[model samples]
Target: METIQAIYDFLQTRTWLQVNDPEEQIVFLAAGEYNENYLITVEEIYGTARHVFRINHGSQLGLANQIEYEFAVLRALARSGVTPRPYYCEPDPGFDELGNGVLLMEYLPGRPLDYAKDWREAASIFAAVHAQPVDDRLIPQPDPVRDIARECEGLIGRYPDHPMTEARDRLLRYRERVLETADEFQTLTADDKPVMANTEVNSHNFLIDDETGRGWLVDWEKCVVTSRFQDLGHFLVPTTTLWKTDFEFGREGRRDFVAAYLELCRAKAGSGMDLETALRCTEIMERTILLRAISWCYMAHYEYTQDGRALRNEDTFARIEQYLDRMAWFFESKT
Candidate 1:
C-alpha cells in the first residue's frame, strides 16, 4: 500500500492530474522496485477519463540509467512496430526527488500469450525484431564476453562459501572456457547498427493469444545492442528442458529456431549480420549462457541439497548435468 500511495502522491502533484482535485477516481494496479504500473480511471465534472501510468520506482538502478533504458526500450519498440501502443511516458523528475520515479503509458489489454503453442512464432517475432536496422543511437556498447567473464569470476570467488561449491566451481571453469573460446574464434559477429535485442527472453516475457498464434514480448528492461544470436540463444537454451516435456519444441524447437534465425540472417545480408556470423555469435552466446546455467545449477543445488530443501528436485541436477554435457558436445563439434 505504501508503494500505491507513493504512486498516487507522485501523480497527484503532476499538472496532468491537478493535485487539488478531490473527485479523482484513482485505482491501484501493481508496484515494485523495478517500476510501479497503474491503471487509473478518473471522472471530471464533464465526463469519464482513463489513464495508464508507469510509476518508475527504479531504485534497483541509478536514476539516469533507469530512465534512459526505459525511454530507449519504448523508442526501440515503437521503431520495430512490435510493441504495445504507448501513449505517453512521464519523463525524469516526473516524481519527487527522493520519493518516487515513474513512467506513464497506455495499458495494453489482452490475455498473456502461451509459449507452448508459439515457440516458433516467438522466434520469428525476434527475427522480425532483429530484422530492423540497428540504431546506433540507442543503448550503450557492451563487451559481452568480458562482462560475462567478470560475472563468472564473481561467482567463483563466492564458491568457497557457497553451499554448491562443486557446481559453482564447474560454472567458474566453464566461464573460463568460454572466454578462451571467444579469444581463439576470429570470425565473431559485430555490427554498428541498431538492434532490438532483448537479453531476457524467457517464457514469462511473452503474452499469447489462445485462439490466434500472435504473441507480444514484454519487459524490455534488458533490451540492448547485443547480437541477435544472443536473443535467439536466450530463447532456445534456457527452455532446453522442453525436450523432456510433452511440449513439441524443446530441443527440436531450439534447432528449428536456430534454423529460422540463420535463414533470416541470410535473407538480410547487407543489413548487417548474416548466417555464418550469426552462427559464430550463437557459439559466443551459448558459451555465455552455459556459464549462467551452470551457475543457476550451482545456486539451485546449494539452496536445495545443502539446505535440505528441494530434496525431490534431484531431477533438476540431472537435467542441468545433461545440459552441460550437451554444451560440451557443442563446443567439440564446432571445434
Candidate 2:
C-alpha cells in the first residue's frame, strides 16, 4: 500500500496532466519476467481525454539503465508507429525504496500475437523495427557471438560448482560448442552489417492491435544493434516453441515466415542484407540462440541456489535439463 501511495504521490507531482482518482485508478497488471507492471488511468483536467499509464518497476540491478535505454529506443521509434510511446523514466534514486527504476509509458491496447495466425505479421513487424535507424550511442553494438561467449564465461565463473553433476557437465559441453560455433560464425559473417535487433524476440513482446491489426513490439529492454539474423533466429526458433503449442511452425510455416521477412526486406530496399548471406547467418544464429538459452538456465540456477532460494532448485534443474534436451535435439536434427 505504501508503494502504491508513493507511486500515486509521484504521479501527482508531474505537471503534464492531472490524476483522476489516483488511489482508485491504479491497478496491478501482469508481472513480466523482469519487472512488475501497473496500469494507471488518468483524465486530463482541461479535456475529456483519458490516458493510460504503463508504469513499469524494474527491480534488477542493471535493468535501471535498460529501462532508460528502452525509453530512448521508444522515442526513436515513435515516428515508426511500431512501439509504445515512452512518457517518463526514473532511475534508482527516484524510487529507491520501491524499485531500482520506474518507467511510465503509453499503455498499448492489444493482445499478444497468435503465432499460428500472426507469424507473417510478426516477421513484418520485426523487419520494420530492424529497418529503423537508431542513434548508435543509445544501443550497444557488440559482436553477438562474442557476447554469448562472454555470458557463458561469466556463468561458469559465477557458479564454479553445481549441485547437479550432470547439469554441470551439460553446461560445460554446451559452452565448448558455443565457443567453437562463435568462432565459425564470426568468420562466416565478418562483414555483416548491424541493425536494430531486439535481443529478446519472444511472442509476448509483440502486441497486435485489435482494431488496426498492426503489431507493436513492446519490452525494449533487451534491444540492441546486432545482426538481424540473431533476432530472426530467436523469433522463429525458441520463441515460437516456448510459449504456444499452436504457434509452433513446421517446415512449411518456417519457410513462409522467412519468405515474408525477405519480401519485406526487398520492399524496404534493405541495405547490407542479402538473401543468401542472411539465410546462412540465420542457420548459424539458431545454434547460438540455443546456447544463449542454456546460458540463461545456468545463470538462473546460480541465482536460485546462491540466494538461499533452495526451494526452487528442483525447478531450476528441471529447466536446465529441458534446455539440454532441446539443444541435443537441435544438433541431432542438423546431423
Candidate 3:
C-alpha cells in the first residue's frame, strides 16, 4: 500500500489525476520478462486520455537508456513500413534511485497474429523492415556471423553438467557439423535483399486484427540489418514441427510455406532465392536454435522451475540431446 501510495504521490507531482471511474483507473495488464505493465486512464488538469506504462521495477537489465530505446523504437517504426506507431516516451532520470525505469506509450488495440495463417504476412513485414534504409545511429553495429557464433559458444559453455553429461559430447558433435556447414553457408549465394535483423519474428511478437485481417509487427529490440534469407529462415523454421504447438505443419506443408514466401519475395524483388539455398539457411538457423535450446534445457534444470514444478534435470538434457540428434538428421536429410 505504501508503494502504491508513493506511485500515486509521484503521479500527483506530475499533475496527473487518477480517475476513480472503472474505465479511468489503472488496470494491470501483462507482466513481461522485466516490467510490470499497466493500462491506465489518467486525467490531467486540462485533458483526459488512456495510456500504457511499463514499470520496470524488478528488471535485471534495469532501465538503462530505456527511454532512448523507446525513441529508437519510435524512429524504427516510423521508418519501417510494417510496425506500430509509438506515441510517447517517459524519460528515466532518477529511476535507479527508485527502481527500474518506466516507459509510457499509447496502447494499441488488436488481436495477436496466428503464426500459421500469417506467416507470409509476417515474413513480408520483416522483408519490408529489412528493405528500409537504416539510420546507422539506430543500428547496433555488430557482425551477424560473429554475434551468432558468440551465442553458440555461450550455449556450448553451459554443457557437461549433470543433465547434459551424457548429451554434452553429442551436442558438441552437432555444433561441429554446424561449424562445417557455416563454411558452406558462406558459399551459398543470396540476393542482397534487405531484412531487419534486430526483430525477433517469433509467433508471439505479431498482432493481427480479426476484422480487417491486418497484422501489426511489434517488438523491435533485436532489429538488425542482415540478409533476407536469415529472416526467412527464422520465420520458417519454427513453423515446422521444431516446437510443440497445438498448430502443426507437416514436412510438405512447411516446404510449401517456404516456397510461397520465396515466390512472394521474387514477385516483389524479381529474383527469389532457390529452395536448396533456403534449406541451407534453415539449417544454419536451426543449429543456432538447437544450441540455445541446449542451454535453456540446462538452465531450466539448474535454475528455473517449469509450470510451478521442479523439472527433472536429467530429463531436460535428454530432451535437448534428442532434439540435437533430430537437427543433425534434418541437416543430413537436406544433404
Candidate 4:
C-alpha cells in the first residue's frame, strides 16, 4: 500500500495523471530473475483515456547502470515502433526503502511468443533490429568469444574447492579448445559488421500480439553492438527450449530461419554479409553461447550453495550436472 502511494505521488508531480485508487488499480504483474515488475492502469479523470505504467524494480548490484543502458536502448528503438517508450528512469529512488532503481515505461500489450508457431516472425523482428544503425557511443561492441572465456574463468576462480572441481577444470580446458577452433573461422567473419544485438534472446523477451501477429522485443539491458550471428545463434540454439517450451526446431526449421533472416538482410542493402558468411559466423557464435550457458549454470550453483558450504537440492544439482554434461559433449564433438 505504501509503495503504491509513493508511486502515485511520484507520478502526480510529473504529469496531470491521477491514480484515484492506487490499491485497486496498481497490480503486481510478474517477477523475473533480477527484478520485480508491476503494472498500473491509469484512467483520465475527465475522459476515457487510459495509460499503463510499467514499474521495473532493480535492487541488485550493478542494476542501476543496467537500467540506464536499458532506458537509452529503449528510447532509441521506440522510434522504430517496436519497443516500449521509456518515460522516466530513477536510478536510485531513495524513497523506496530498499533503494531500488525504478524504470517507468509504457506497458506493452502482448504475451510470450510461441516459437514453434512464430519462428518466421521472430526471425524477422531480429532482422529488423539488426537493420537499424547503431550509435557506438551508446551501445558497446562485445568480443563474443573472448568475453565468454573471461566470464567462465571468473566463475571458476570463485569456487576453487567445489565437489565438481575436476569437472570445472575439464570445462576450462574445453573452453580453450573451443576458442582455438573459433579462431580458425575468424577470417571468415573478419569483415562482418556490427549491429544491435539483444544478447539475451529468450522467447519470453519477445512479446507477440495475437491479434496483429506482430512482435515487440523487450528487455534491452543486455543489448550490444555485436555480430548479427550472436543474436541469430542465440535464437536458433536448442537451449532456448529451456525457456520456450514450443521451441523444438529441427535442422530444417533452423535452416529456414537462417534463410528468412538472410533474405531480409540482403533486402536491406549495404549489410555486406552473404549467406555463407552468416552461416559460418553463426556456427562460431553458437559455440560461445554454450560456453556462456556453462558459466551461468556454474555460477547459479555457486550462488545457491553460498560459496560451496550449503547443500543444493536434488533437482537443482541435476540441472547443473545436465548443463555440465552438455558442455562436455560439445567439447568431445569438437575433438
Cand. 4 Cα-lDDT: 0.68
Cα-based RMSD of the predictions, in order?
Answer: 6.7, 3.6, 5.6, 3.9
Q: Give lDDT tens digits, candidate 1, residues 146-226.
A: 665675565456446665455455555667677875653333653434356876666645666556646677666666676
* Model 4 C-alpha lDDT per residue in residues 1-335, reported as the tens digit of each score: 66667777776665535567778777667555455566776666565443434344442223447667777777777765677778877666566631345677777778887777888888778878877778665655456677667766777776666677766878688688668755655567677667878878888788899998888888776777777788887787665555446445676776788888888777776456666667767767777776766766776676666654222445546666676667666555334
Local lDDT at 156 for model 1: 52
Q: What TM-score number comes out for model 1?
A: 0.68
Off by over 4 Å in 4: 1-6, 45-64, 97-99, 307-335
lDDT, candidate 3, 96-188, per-residue tens: 422445555556556655666776676566556655665565444233334555555565564335464545566566566556655555556
The better-scoring model by TM-score among 1 and 2 is 2
**For each candidate, what TM-score against the reference?**
0.68, 0.84, 0.71, 0.84
Residue 68 in candidate 2, Cα distance off native in Å:
1.7
Against the reference, the lDDT scores of all candidates come to: 0.56, 0.66, 0.54, 0.68
**Candidate 4 clashes between residue pairs 3 or more apart in a chain or in different chains:** none
Q: Which residue runs does candidate 3 get wrong by more than 4 Å?
A: 1-24, 42-50, 56-67, 90-99, 138-146, 156-164, 189-194, 238-244, 266-272, 305-335
Q: Is candidate 1 or candidate 3 better by TM-score?
A: 3
Report the lDDT of model 1 for residue 146.
65
Better of 2 and 3 by TM-score: 2
